[model samples]
Target: WLLFLGITLFQIPRIASQFKEENWHRISETIPVSEGTMLLTLDTQAEDPDFNEVSLKIEGTADSLVTLEKEFFSRGKTKAESLENAKVLGYQVSVLDSLVSFPPGFDYSAMDVFRDQKVNLILKVPYEKPFLMDRSLLDILRNTIYRNGYKSRDVREKNIWAFNEAGLVCLTCGSTTDETENQDPNEDQTEEEQINREKLDSLSRAKFRQRLDSIE
Candidate 1:
């Protein structure tokens, strides 16, 4: 009985840690920054039902190299299977040259099953380096407020932003003194807002198609 109690106590910490890790799968990757402006976009990817929910946060890091942080929750019948789910999700983020593009959601076909799959992306920019988020991304950049004391939806997308000694700052916001911490990623979204964003995306797609047809 004594040995059993000792063993159980020893295993408790490991069990707790495993439980925590299982709930939150984290992935970090280093993106090579180009000499000038870097562009971020996910708008080009067509939205699919399998992977429809995604949230992204833009942050600044002093690390020099551009860092992309990803977190998600996935489940399976066993720990090994769950890890495999995470591995499949990790493969979906593709960075090409100065343009870093990630899907609004992951591809479910590769994931095997959907276990409350949610992907949250954080794009970390280097200090004083310029970056722009494609206007189409206004929907996915959720629960995040900008450094100029504004939220993603409120800021004008055409201008550039960058990280500096004070954290994230707008290169063209005109006023540089405003700085605040980013909001929590867990904020809830309203059903009305979701519907509106879907409409906007559909309209953007239509406009893009029209432009292509006119060119041809």
Candidate 2:
């Protein structure tokens, strides 16, 4: 009994050290984190094994998404205390509700290099104006959010959504709850095509349409 206790105590420190080391490595690969931004981790034990008991939540503006996505790519691969050292696990990208499946050979270093491309694409979306995404895209994004364990109401507040590797709902947009009360769902339907053509800046509209087409 004494030997077992001693061994368990020694293992505790080792395990804690390992967890911290892995976390630091994950953070290093995540670039362009806005100055003064905070990174938070939450662990909640659950009886179910399919879902992660712990989750990482980030709060930032749309522009910060680039950094967030890169961190996600990096951290998702690194061995976490909970993930059993699996190189790739389930993940969701909320911006487009896109399921970023980790192929057998996904490399975090390679993904870091492409971060700029994703950031550039995000820049194309004007934050100053209320941009309207197609319903289909919104649905996809919303679904991703749900898979991430966030509710639709919460995601509507942030106007973003997320998904996981198994295409599960993980998080939802957290926009103003009152939005649904003020706007009619059908209001945008009639104007979608016309607004796409007339209101948006020409180049921006083209870019948006191009992205929409690619997703389809």
Candidate 3:
């Protein structure tokens, strides 16, 4: 019994290290675009821990609704475990009356195999034409944009720029460099700045409240 326990403890670290290196796959597809404004939707049915990062590129003249560049990450003990779990998941893309939807599909009864697994997706779409998105995608982007310090009155006003030759552009809360540099050191902060600071503060407070509530 002592030897068995010792060998199990020795293999624990190796098993953990293998899971730490996540497995992923990438696929790109271009679908034909119908006339009028495009609608993008990301629908998921699994209750697993999934994170999606979606962005847009606005320079291109092609014959498609949008180009979907997708990368799927698997969080499992082994590559084969992740890949097999991912196979059970599904992605559906359809266009109806200028509305393009990407909804998640899978058999709910078969989701028992999804324990401790996650699916992280990175979707890139063309932004040359006008498009609308579902609330799920909007919420994800809103949290990311807000965390990056861009306080837009509406999500529609927010735009993702193309990556420049110098690499990724620095994200700001819609503050210009000149304005940041020209601010008077001794002058009081503006109301907008104060509000932004408060908003950030509230996020931490909200998390603390949740923890307290859980304990109660």
- Evaluated with TM-score, which candidate comes out highest? 1
| TM-scores for candidates 1 onward, in order | 0.60, 0.26, 0.45
Best by lDDT: 1
Query: Cα lDDT for residue 53, model 3?
Result: 31
Q: Count the backbone clashes (under 3 Å) in each candidate.
A: 0, 28, 3
Which candidate do you rate higher for lDDT, 1 or 2? 1
lDDT of each: 0.61, 0.29, 0.44
**C-alpha RMSD between model 2 and the true structure:** 15.2
For candidate 3, write residues 92-164 as lDDT tens digits.
4665766655544222244444334333334443323445544455533423323333333323323222112
lDDT of 1 by residue, 87-115 (tens): 67643555667877766666556766555
In candidate 1, which residue pairs get closer than 3 Å at backbone N, Cα or C atoms, i.e. clash? none
How do the residues 103-212 of candidate 2 rate in per-residue lDDT, one tens digit apiece? 11122233322211111011111122222222323321322333333344443323432211122221212123543322112333346643442333344334534655
Q: Which 10 consecutive residues of model 3 have the lowest summed lDDT? A: 162-171
- lDDT of residue 62 for candidate 2: 35
Return the lDDT, model 1, position 140. 76
Segments of candidate 2 deviating more than 4 angstroms: 22-68, 73-124, 127-179, 183-216
For candidate 2, the lDDT comes to: 0.29
